[model samples]
Target: MSAPETIAVAMSGGVDSSAVAALLREQGHTLVGLTLQLWNQRRLAGHEGMPESVQGRCCSIDDVYDARRVAEHLGIPYYLVNQEERFENEVVKPFVSEYLAGRTPIPCTLCNNHLKFDALLITARQIGADRIATGHYARNHYDEARGRWILSRPADRSKDQTYFLFGLTQDQLAHTLFPLGEMTKPVVRQMAADAGLALAKKPDSQEICFIPGGDYSAFLAAYLEDVGEEQPDLSGELVSTAGEVLGKHAGIHTVTVGQRKGLGLTSPNPLYVLQIHPESHAVTVGSEAELMGTELYADRLNWISIAELTEPIRVEAKIRHRHEPAWATLSPAGEGLAHVVFDEPQRAITPGQSAIFFQGDEVVGGGWIVNRNS
Candidate 1:
C-alpha cells in the first residue's frame, strides 16, 4: 500500500481554505494545517482612526481560532507560524513607502509573493511536508511539451487571482498546489457546509488585512505614528498635463491616478488625475481623454509559461485585476523590462501596479508598470 502524502495546507480560517483542507483530507492526504500570523491587529489599535476590533481582516486572532477549530474538526495537527516581522518589512513597509512616493501599491500581491508563498514554503519544508496547498483561485500544471510549469486562469474567472500571483517562480509553482482553483466561491462555501465546518458563510476578506476599513491613507498616518516617524511631506501643486499649475493640494498621499473628487478646485469640465510625480511631488490633472494610453513599460519581469522572452510575442495584457485582457504586442525593451503596445488604448494605466501578459488562459509573464507613453 502506498503511504499518504504529507501536505501542509495554509488555512486562513475562511470557508475557501477550510474547504481546501476538507477536500485534501478526504483524498487521504496527511495534512498539517498552518495559519501564518502575518499581522497583529491590536498592535496599532486605539490609535487615531485605527480600529481596535480585529473583525473582517485576514489572519486575525479570531481567524486563527477558527482555523484551529477547523483543524480540530478534521482531526489534524494545526500550527500558527509567527511571521509578523517579515510581513511588516516585506509587505507593509513597502506598501507605505510606495503610497508615500505618490504611487499606488498592491499589498496583497506583495504579501503573496513575499510572505505566503516564500515564507510558507520554507516553513512547510521544515515541518516535513513535501508540498504546500492554498485556496487561491488560480491553476498551475506542469507542461511537458514546453518543459515548464505553467500558471493559468482558473475556471472561476471572476475569482481569478493569477494577477497577484505573477511573482511566483518556477520552483515555487512546482512545490505549490491550489485545490480550490477549479471551484467557484459558492461551490466552496457549499462544500464547507457539507463538511460540517463553521465559517461556511464567512464573507470574503476584501480590505488590506492590516488596514482596517480599507483606508490606506488613514493606515499610513496611523502606522507612521505607531513607528514614531513623521509622515513625509506630500504637499504639492496640482498641475495640468501641459505643466500649467492649477492649484495647491494638501498632499500626494490622498490622491491617485484617475481620481476626480477632492481636487478642491472648480473647473468648466470635470477633471481627472493624469499622473503623479514622486520626485517633484506634482499631481497632474486633465480631461478624461488624457487617461487613455496605448503604450507602457514594465520592469522586474517574471515569465511563467516561457523560460525567457527572446522575441516580440503577441499577448493579451491586463493592467488591473478586474481589467479584461487587451490585445497587445510585447517586446523586450532591455534587461528585466518589456515594452507593451496595446492594440487599443487602455485607461488609467497606473504605475506600481502589475501588468500581466496572457496567451489565451495561460499566463505568459508579468511585471510592474513603470511608465506609460500616451
Candidate 2:
C-alpha cells in the first residue's frame, strides 16, 4: 500500500495480462487494472439462454470476476469499464457486415484500434496514468537518436503480436508498455508462478472472443438485426470469373474469400469462392489458382511510421493480421487512398479486409482494401 508511480495495466485475467500486472508491481509502480467489457457474440449460438461466465471468454461475465480476483490478489485497484457501445460500432458490427459482404473480418485488429489501445489509453490520460500497459506479445523501443517509438517482436516468434497492432498510433505507442514482451510465454508463466498467481499454467484462449462455438454464420444470423442480416436470399447464380454458372447460393455472406467447402454444389474439380458481388448478390466461385491476386487498393490509411506521408513508400504488406509480411510498394491516392502492389501475389486478397504495412518487423501503416487483383 505504499505510494508508487501510477500506471494502468489492462488485465484480461489471462496468463499474459496477469503476468504483466505482477511485473509492474515488482517494479514498484502503482498498478490500476482496467478491463473493458465487450459484448459477447457467442450468446447468439446454442448457449444463448445459459448465463455467460467470464471464466473462459474476455467479454464474458465470468471474465470480469477473474480479472477482479487477479487485481485483488495483486493488491491493486481494478475496474471493469463498459465499452459495449464502442465495441458494437467498431468491432462486432463490422465483423458481421464483413462476413455478410463475403470477406473475413479481423476482430482482433478492430479491438486493438477501437477498444484496447485507443479507448483505454485515452482513459489512462484522463486518470493521470504515467503509462498504459497490456499483455500483448510485442516489444516497443524508443529510438533515442531519431526520437521515435518502434514496434518489434517478442522473444516468442509464434506468439509475436506486432501484426495485430499495426493500427496503433504514435501517440498511443508513446504511453504504452508491455512488461511481458521481453520474455517468452514460458518465462511469463514462470514469473506468474513465482508470484503465486492463479493463472500461471492456464491454457491460452484460442477461439475468437465473440465466436464461442466457432460457427460464424450461425452467430451472425442471431446477433445482426439488419433487415438482411438473416441469410440473404440471393436470386443470382454462382458464376465463375469466366462467366460460367457453377451453382446457386442463398446469400453471399455464407461464403468468404479463400473458402472452398460446404458450397453445396457438385463440380468436376473442387470449387472456391473467389469474390463476392454484393450488388448482384452473387458469390463468385472459381478454381484455387484464380484466387491469387498481386495488386490491391486500400483506403482509410493509417500511417504509424512518421509524421507525414511525403511520397510513395516501400514496406511489407499484410492482407490481414497474422499473415506473414510481404514486400510491397505503396502510393497514396490523394485523400486517404493507397495503391499497394505486392512483389508477389497474395491469396484471397478480399475487399472489406485490412492490408497492414510494416517496415521489417515494425508496423509502418495500413488501410482497408478497396480492390484486389483477384
Candidate 3:
C-alpha cells in the first residue's frame, strides 16, 4: 500500500464508488465523501427512465440523499458541491455540439478528465485532502525503478476502465488512487456485502447519469431548443468507397465507425460504416472489409511514462472504448501528434474518439483520435 494519506472519495451514489470508500475505510484512510450537483435541481423532467427520485437526471435529489446516507453510515463527512456551470461548459454543451457535428462522443471520458478528476481534484486539494481516489476498475502503480506512476488494466479484465482514463496526465496519476483496481467486480460486491454496506446490493448504473432514458438525440434536440437555437440540417450523404451513393442519413451523430446495423440501409449483404467526413458531411459505407484501417493519427498526446516520445514505441493500441487491443507501432510526429500504424488492419477507426496506447497491462498514454484511414 502507498503511504497513508487523507483521501477524499468521489461518491457517485453508485455501488462502485461506495465500495471504494468502504475499502479505504477498512484500510484506515481518512475519508470525506464528495459528490457534485452538476445541474439545476428544479424541473428534471427532461431526464426520462430514471428512478422515482431521479426526476429528469443530472444531480437528482435521490442521488444527493443516497450519497449523504452512505457518508453518514460510514461516519464520514460529506459534501455535495455545485458544479452545474462547469458541467454545462465542459460536458453538456460539448456533448450536444459533438453529436451535431456527426460523432459519437464519449462524454464519460470528458467528464472524468475535466469535471471529475481535474476540477474535482482541485477542489479536494483546497479542502486539505492529501489525494483524490475513485472507484474506477483500473490499477495505478508507482514504479520506483522508472520513477513514474503506471496506469494498468485491473485484475478485473472484463471490467477494465483504462479506456476512459487515457486523458489523465502524469501529475494526475501521481495523486490519484483506484481502490478497486486489484479486485474483480464480483469480489468487490462480495466485500461490500460482507461489510453489510447498503450499496453491496445496489444495481450498477447503466445509462449515462445525465441522460437517463437514453434518447441522446432527443435530449440534444430539446436541449438545443431550450437555448432557442434552430436545429441545423445535420443530414449527410451515405456513400461507398468508390463514390457510389447508398442512402441518406439524418445526422452523423447517429452513426459511428464500424457500425453495421441500424443504418436503415438495405443491400445485398450486410453493410458497414467505414468513413465519416464531418467536413463534407458524408458517411461512407461498404462491406466489413472497408472498415479495416491500418493507420491512425491523434492529437493532444499526454504521455504517462518517458514524459515524451521522441521515437516509435512498440505497444498495444485500443481504438474504441470496448474494442480489444491490437498490436501497433506508435511514433511521435513533430510538434505533438502520435502516428499509430497498426500491425493488422483495424476496423472502423472513427474520428472524434480516443486511441489509447498500452504496454502490456500498463497504459503508456493516449490522446484524441483523428485523421483515420482504411
Candidate 4:
C-alpha cells in the first residue's frame, strides 16, 4: 500500500467538518485539523447592545473547544491559527465600512475570498499539508476541455454556499476541497456518529461569526465606538422617489433597502426604503414597486468558467444570497464592470452585495453590485 494523502481539514467544531475529518481519516489519509480563530467574541462584550455571552455563535471559544475535541477523537493533529488581525483588516473593517456607506455587505463572502481560501491555503501549505478542505457546500472540478477549474453548485441545493464563494480564483479552487459537497446535512451528522465524533448532533452556526445576535446595527454602533471613531453624520431628509420630503432620518447607516418598518413615518400607505444616498445622506422611501429594477451594473469582476468575459451572454443572475436566480443578459460594460438586464425586475438590488452569474449549476463569474438603473 502507498502512503496516505496528507489533507488539512478546516474544522469549525460543527457536525459537517467533524464528519469530514473522520471520513478522510477513515480513508487512511494523514489528517490535520485546522480551526481559524477569526474573531474574538469578547472584544466587544459589555458594550451597549452587544451580547455579553457569545457561546452559541460561530468561532467562539466553545467552538474551538469542540474542534479540538474532535481532533483528539480522531487522534489527528490540531492547531488554532490566530488570524484576528487579518480577519479584522480583511473582513470586519470592510463590513463596517460598507454599512456606513449605506450598502449591505456580505462579510461571509469577504471572509471566504480574503481569508479562508487565501490565507488558510497559505497556512495549510506551510504546515506541509497537500490541500485544505472546508465544510462549504460547493464543488469544483478542473475542466480539461476548458482549461480552468469550474465551480459548481453542490448536490444539496438547500445548503448551497456558492453565492458567497463566487470570488474564488482558479488557483484557490485548485488547492481547496469541499468534502460535504455531495452529502446532505443529515447524512453528514450520521457519518460523524459512525466515526464516534461528539459533535455529530451539534447544531450548525447560522449567525455571522463576529456579530453576536446577528444585529448589524448594534454591532456597527459598538464597533465604531470601540475603535474611537464617531458614527458618520448621516442625518438627512427622508424623500420620496419624486423628491418629496416625508420626514427626517437619523442616519443612512440605520436603514437598508427594502426595509418597511421603523421609518418613523405614518402614512395611509406603507413605505419602504427604496434607496440610500451616502453622499447627501438622503434616505429614499417609496412603495415596494419602486424597489424593483431590471438592470444592474456590477464591478470587481472575477470570472471562473472563462478567462474573461468579452461579450454578452445569457445567464441566471443572483443579486443576493436568498434571492432566486433570474434569467438575464450579462454584457461587458467597460473595464472591470458588467451590465446585467434581468427578464424580471429584482427587488432591493443593493450595492456592496455580490452579483453571481450562473449557467445552470456552474458559476460563470461574479462581481460587486455598484448601481442599478432607475
lDDT of 4 at 23: 85
CA lDDT of 86 in candidate 1?
A: 93
- Candidate 4 local lDDT, 1-374, one digit each (tens): 13677888998888888888898888899989999999989999999999888899988899999999999989999999989999999999999999999999999999987788787788889989988888889999999999999999999999989999998989999988888898888888889999988778888888999888778889999999999999878789999989999999888888988899989999999899988899999999999888889999999899999999999999999988898899999999997889999998889989888999999999999999999775
Candidate 4 vs. true structure, TM-score: 0.98
Q: Which 10-residue window in model 1 sums to the lowest lDDT?
A: 1-10
- lDDT at position 30, candidate 3: 90
Q: Candidate 3 overall Cα lDDT vs. reference?
A: 0.81
lDDT of 1 by residue, 252-276 (tens): 8889888998899799999998899
RMSD of each: 1.5, 3.1, 2.5, 1.4
Q: After superposition, how far is residue 110 of candidate 3 from its true place, in Å?
A: 0.9
What clash count goes with each model? 0, 4, 2, 0
Position 238, candidate 4: lDDT: 98
TM values, all candidates: 0.97, 0.90, 0.92, 0.98
Residue 88 displacement (Å), model 2: 1.7
**In angstroms, how far off is 223's CA in candidate 3?**
1.3
Error of 3 at 151 (Å): 1.2
Rank order (by lDDT, best first): 1, 4, 3, 2
Q: Candidate 2's residue-wise lDDT over 223-278, tens digit each?
A: 75433444556446789888888778767776778889888888898888888887
